[model samples]
Each structure stands twice: as C-alpha cells, then as structure tokens.
Target: MGDSIGFNVFSFFFLFFLTDIAGVSPAIAGTISLIAVLWDAITDPIIGFISDNLRSKYGRRRPMMIVSSVPYAVCTFLSKEIRNLFYPRNCLRI
Candidate 1:
C-alpha cells in the first residue's frame, strides 16, 4: 500500500541520515532503527483494529489519514530537507 511505501522510504533514508550526517555510530543507528521497527510492529495491528472498529463518520482509514496529514506533511518535508540544511557535529553523536 501507499502508506507502507512512505514508512519504507523514510526508514531507508533516515538510517543514512542518522549514521552519516548526524554522526551517530553505526551501532546506535541500527539500534534506533530497530526500536522504530519494534514500535511499528507493536502499533500497526492495534491501530488497524481501532480503525476497523471505529464509529467515525468518515470511517476507518480516511479519518486517520485526515488527522495524520498535517504531521505527515511536516515530517516528510523536514526529512527530505534535513540532509542539506543541517549537520551538527558533537550534538547527537554518541
């Protein structure tokens, strides 16, 4: 699905962003990514259930998408621009 693509692309770019530009160690970057994977794994099914059994007028996925649009747009734009705009050394490095 389209939603899944967004996550996959973000993860692909984000790992490089963390390790290369952010100066995080490879180990730390992998751990951070693993944490995200675990969280996604845990939340996806619960959210799916909630959306499936929801009583909203818009129903199911639409309402979630509508609510998530703002954050998603902000994050997507920010992620796309991060590699060019900033590279803070000794800031987030481990």
Candidate 2:
C-alpha cells in the first residue's frame, strides 16, 4: 500500500514538476520517464537474482535491505536538497 502510494505520488508530481516548473517539454519529460521505467524494469530482475544468490549471516535479503536503507535515505535527502538549492524556482515551498 505504501509503495503504491509512493509510486503514484512520485509519478504524478514528477512529470508535472518537470514540465510545468522545470521548463521541460511534455514530450521530453515523458521520454525521460519512460527511460526511468524501463531502467527500473531491467533492474528488478537483476536485483532479485542477486538477492536470491546472496549468502550472509543475516540472511539473503534482510541484510541487503538494512544495509541499503541508509544509502537510500541519504540519496533521497541529497536529491531533495540539491533540487531545492539549485532549482529554487521550481522547488516546492514548504
């Protein structure tokens, strides 16, 4: 449920934000989104393969999930910060 909501929010807002505020054309924004979707589709199976093959004391997937959380959070934070800093005109005020 959470994942679904997050994906929906990201997809809807990302396109609008890119085209409306960031001055990207709709076609280009759509192409970029399509590329992202394709990249995600390609990576899912690769990550699943890795997770299935991984051997660790903590288990196959849990350790990877735990270890990846910090970097994921950091990346999310940095992306938002960079956008706010470098694209203040397009940044959402909160």
TM-score of each: 0.73, 0.82
lDDT of 2 at 84: 66
Clashes of 2: 0
lDDT of 1 by residue, 20-40 (tens): 867799999999989988999
> Number of backbone collisions per candidate, in order?
0, 0
Give per-model CA RMSD: 4.7, 2.5
Candidate number of the best lDDT: 2
Flag clash pairs in model 1: none
Write down the lDDT of every candidate, Cα atoms only. Answer: 0.80, 0.85
